[model samples]
Target: MKNYTVVAKDSFTVLGIGTELRSDYTDYAGITKEKADFWESIKQDGRLETLKAVATNNYIFAVNEAVNNKMMHYAGVMTEASVPEASRLIQFPKGEYLVVKGEAQTAEELSNKLTGIAFGQVLSEVKDVAYVGGPNATVEMGQQNGILFGEMWIPVVRK
Candidate 1:
């Protein structure tokens, strides 16, 4: 079973890149490829290091918006530095969030668990905690450990 916590967070911004994905949950290979490509490109061009240098925290975000079969996914860092020309910037306004910790042997496993289970559970049960919908921001925080450590952040407000 997975456990969650509600935390108040200040507003933050992320600088990186993104791509839109459209696929049924049963066929997410396309979206996975797109995310991998974005990360690979950034690493190849040394942009990842640039963003990491100015990052306020070690957490990297894999933000997503899934409505119906369409999803827009962003792989980015929480940073105050100017994004590279090849990258995009996303701003997450201040809000309370439902946070959950996750661990996996690989990044792919981590992503699957967050999207397929963790976030789903939070969204469905948030009302029990007086959660009110706010921004649609769903952020996946990446850990620096050898094992893939992640935290999923879902924005919500108290009713």
Candidate 2:
């Protein structure tokens, strides 16, 4: 069984710099490439570092959400403060969340692994809750033993 847990969480806001994901929803490879490219651009341009400077903690958040029928992705941090360069203040509603944890050699691998496990395996097996759709995130908390570790948090509703 995939290692996961459902937990209650308080509402929080993430300040982010975002881009609309243009790939078809069914195209996993396209979507993954778009996300990877976006992250690379942000990192190279110092956008990620700017967001990190205002972060409440060291955790870096890569969030996905559908906004007005458009697939949106963000590189963000948890903070009440805002930067003029930020694209949005994404809000995560207070609720139960399906949390999937994992670690990998790189942040990119860790995100892909956790996301695959969460959607491809765990969400399908869980009987008591369902993901109703909002902003979901892959939180890159830190590194340990040269490995990147994080958790994917998807808000869920109990069935």
Q: List lDDT for all candidates, in order.
A: 0.65, 0.93
Q: What is the TM-score of each candidate against the true structure?
A: 0.73, 0.97
Could you give candidate 2's per-residue lDDT for residues 56-143 as a string of tens digits?
9998998999999999999999997888779999999998999999999987898889999999999999999999899999999999
Off by over 4 Å in 1: 22-27, 65-70, 129-145
Candidate 1 lDDT, 42-121, residue by residue in tens: 67987767777777887667777553455667666777667555256666668777777778877667766766565457
Clashing pairs in 1: none
Q: Model 1 shows how many backbone clashes? A: 0
lDDT of model 2, residue 82:
86
